[model samples]
Target: MNTEVPRLSVVVPVFNEQDVLPLFVERIRPVLDELGLTYEVVAVDDGSRDATPVVLGLLRRRWPQLRVVRLRRNSGHQSALAAGLRRARGQYLVSIDVDLQDPPEVIGDMLRLAQREGLDVVHGVRADRSSDSVFKRWTASLYYRLIQRMAGAAIPRHAGDFRLLSRTAVDALVALPEHLPVYRLLVPWLGLPSGEITYTRAPRAAGRSKYPVAKMIRLALDSIVGFSAAPLRVATWLGLIGIGICAVLAGAGVTAHLSGTTVPGWTSLLVALLFLGALQLLCLGLLGEYVARIFTSLQGRPAYVVAFDSATDAEPAEDALCRL
Candidate 1:
């Protein structure tokens, strides 16, 4: 095992990407090799249920620089990425997906920009995403706009998890107490000196996308709730609006009764009840989202459990976790 610190570490969080793993390795390996840097690719397998483990093992044998960290269960993408980031052993760390959407070729440019300009972080922004579906592009646009509005525009427009971070930036991120961090927002919120590298997003090399509509919605909720208290404030406003509406309804009812103009108020009463009920539910749901986060934090559970790590199995548990 090479105990010396490498110049770069690429942290790849992969799920069931058996079909694309080889293709990713073929493309990414050569690019890193050409850089002439002693680097390691930390591939964190997020409890894949397919032949992904087998493929990674085979790839590791051929490419000694490739290290595999297998999680005990299917933790989400961000958790897997966090695991890789914690485990990566390099001076400079780059996080990218195995789907090949973000080109590996631009990595060299990112490193150069970081070195030349003394940037602590380099974001890989999608200059063009023509390959995405119309619905996807529209939703992505809305997601970014909404988040940028709440979290501020310090975050680049089209950047995702594909970015480079200096050791300092990585250490800062790992030091944060958040267990389920939305890195898209958290990284920018760190207020580190950063730059962006634009790349045309490509279609996946192989396999189905791990993120579906449900997961995307979950991610949006996490990003919002984790960063801002705007949801709770919105809930407060809603409750106030509900109270105002009820007050107006009550005054109108009293006037009708006093004037002896009251007939059957059943319809109006039912409508008011339904409206109030919906508002109450909405407020509870928003509050519940926040309460859930607090509960998770209190539990103090690690987001992922490492079943095995090819390179760091011999290292002490504390050192391996990078919690020190």
Candidate 2:
């Protein structure tokens, strides 16, 4: 490892991305090289089941500027990113993914903008996501809109994890006590001098997307529960509505009995009972989600465990020494 701190550290969290690693390196290395800044690429392997670890090992051997940090298990992408951020030793840290959907070339723009404006954070916002599938675009729009309504902070409309942070910003993020942090919300909550750079998001260069419907839903839940009390409030509203409906039904039953037209109907009564029961259950589930997060947080577990770090075993070399 270089004893001297680098000017920039580009952190990429990897899962089963064996096929895309080479292509990512091919595209990003040149951008860093042309910038003429001392930099290191810190790729955190989030316990890939494929040959990603082996590929990273070989890449590190040839590309001395590359450093690999392997996690003990698959702890998800955000956790892996947190690991990289904590390990980064640079004046500025840039976090991007290996899929190349968020263009690596934009890093130059982010760096320039940050330096020019004296900003602590530079977010790469997707100006156009026409390249993505219709479903992806729709869900992304909904997620951002929902977060804006519920979260206590204002997250950029179309920003993902592709962002640049100064040392101060990185330190603030790393110091946060969240075990499953939603960086999009947490970063904005920090109240830093941040700017945005617009880019047309490109399609993935290789391999399948890691985030599927289930994972996306999980991410949304984590973000909502971690950063807002809206779910609990919604639960409260549901309970109130259920009570009001029950009272209305009781009043109708009393009026019918007084008028000598009380119809004995088990079906309607059963339906109303079932509906209220279901609503109560749903409210309880929502409260449980928040309670679960609180319980997990109090456990004080590390987000990810690193099995290996290439920097500890390898010597550092000049930036962008290896080329495709």
Candidate 3:
């Protein structure tokens, strides 16, 4: 095991990315090597069912800087990233996806900016995303805008997880008590000295996108619920609106009865009942989401479990720091 801490750590959270692993390495290695910095690439395998683990094992033999951490089960991307961040032994840390859509070459720029400007965080913002599907681009735009409004943070508009963090920023993130953290929001909320570099996002080198519509929606929910109480406030507003409607209906009912023109229509009553019921249910559902997260946090369950860590000499102990 290498006891020496590297100057930089590149943490890549991957799941079933067998086809793109080689290409990712091919592109990223040269950038790191050219920068002439001591670095380690920590690739967290989020319980891949394909050849990802095998490929990583083979790559480790060739690239000594490559360290593989396999989760015991299929943890989500953020969980896998958290595991890597905890295990990283570097002065500077970076989180990027294995898809290669965010250019690997830009890593050098991030490092340089972090050093030259003395910034704690350097964000790799996307200048152009012309390669993405129409739906993806649209939803991503809406997601970023919505999160900024709800979270009350000026998170970079087009920045994903591709960014550099200084040692102080890394330690601060690791110490956060959040069970389900949205790094995009959490990092900006840190109020660290930050800078941004724009890059044109390229198409994936190979394989399909791991983040489908369902996962995207899940991530958005986590971000919204984890950082802000705007959902609860929205629910309050909805309840008020529902009450106003009911009051108006009651006034109409009383006026019609007093005027002696009471047309007994089941259809109007049924529509009003259904609409109010649906609105009530929607508000309850939103509240339920926050309550469920609180319940999970109170249970004290680990966010992720590591099945194996290639960087360690012995098996991870029961109380390992990476347990969460």
Candidate 4:
């Protein structure tokens, strides 16, 4: 860890959030001021196509402590987060969404717990998340529990990216080299001195959520395969079960032929074949998913490509991105 200490560094991953920035800054500034601590807001511009950068430029001009990270293109949320963590200088780091759904004031509670309890990471768990749709709530519940059961890692339930980590925790996280990082899983695996604070997750101040069903499925698969080998094990188990079924059916067919009862119902045989074939394919597909992740990792591709950065406080680096 560096000898110089920063009181707090808030890393907000920005997407198409132009409408919310003005209100977000207004709400966050007073809370930080009340804490009476030196802080910096790392607003990560994750290749937003909206006026997000313009708003960030305005904010940076107004508040010198504001630091902006511009990704070369639209990296997913986790990659954008990884980019911000790479550049954070604070002794304690806080990760949040720019939507302002998680109140800025929650940081006060997290910081308080960190100081008083001497914890390495403080998680902000929502006491009530009913603001989300019923389907979303159900899926989220299932996803967290399934990850915990299958992954063998004790990821906190109801904990999103809204959390605070001490310098030690931050260092441990940054040392990890997995090209694809699922932050929720990685934090628990680090095994830090963790604590949780309860809060009400507010509805978004503007715009719909960035995470739709398809994105949620992608994230779930990444978390499961990235952290646990259970999926691969399941693939093995499924193949073994299929073999057992096939052997039993073959024996039955031989017995029928010997007894001279003669096999009847070609439809039944066809049904059995289809069912077994489907199972075989499903198991193979699961194996393929794990193999695909390994192949992607072996390629040594960065999780995110930073086309340009202005974190050093220079003029906007002209778009280095090329069109196809």
lDDT of 3 by residue, 53-81 (tens): 87887777789999989998898999999
Q: lDDT per prediction?
A: 0.91, 0.90, 0.92, 0.86
Cα lDDT for residue 244, candidate 1: 94
lDDT of the structure predicted as candidate 1: 0.91
**Pairwise lDDT winner, candidates 1 and 2:** 1
lDDT score at residue 198, model 1, on the 0-100 scale: 97
Which model is ahead, 2 or 4, in terms of lDDT? 2
Query: In model 2, which runs have C-alpha deviations exceeding 4 angstroms?
Result: 313-324
> Per-residue CA lDDT of candidate 2, range 209-237, in tens?
99999999999999898888999899889
Tens digit of lDDT per residue, candidate 1, span 19-81? 999999999999999999999999998999998887887787789899989999999999998
lDDT, candidate 1, at 293: 89
Q: Worst 10-residue stretch by lDDT in candidate 4?
A: 315-324
Better of 2 and 4 by TM-score: 2
What lDDT does candidate 2 reach at residue 7? 97
* Candidate 3 weakest ten by summed lDDT: 315-324
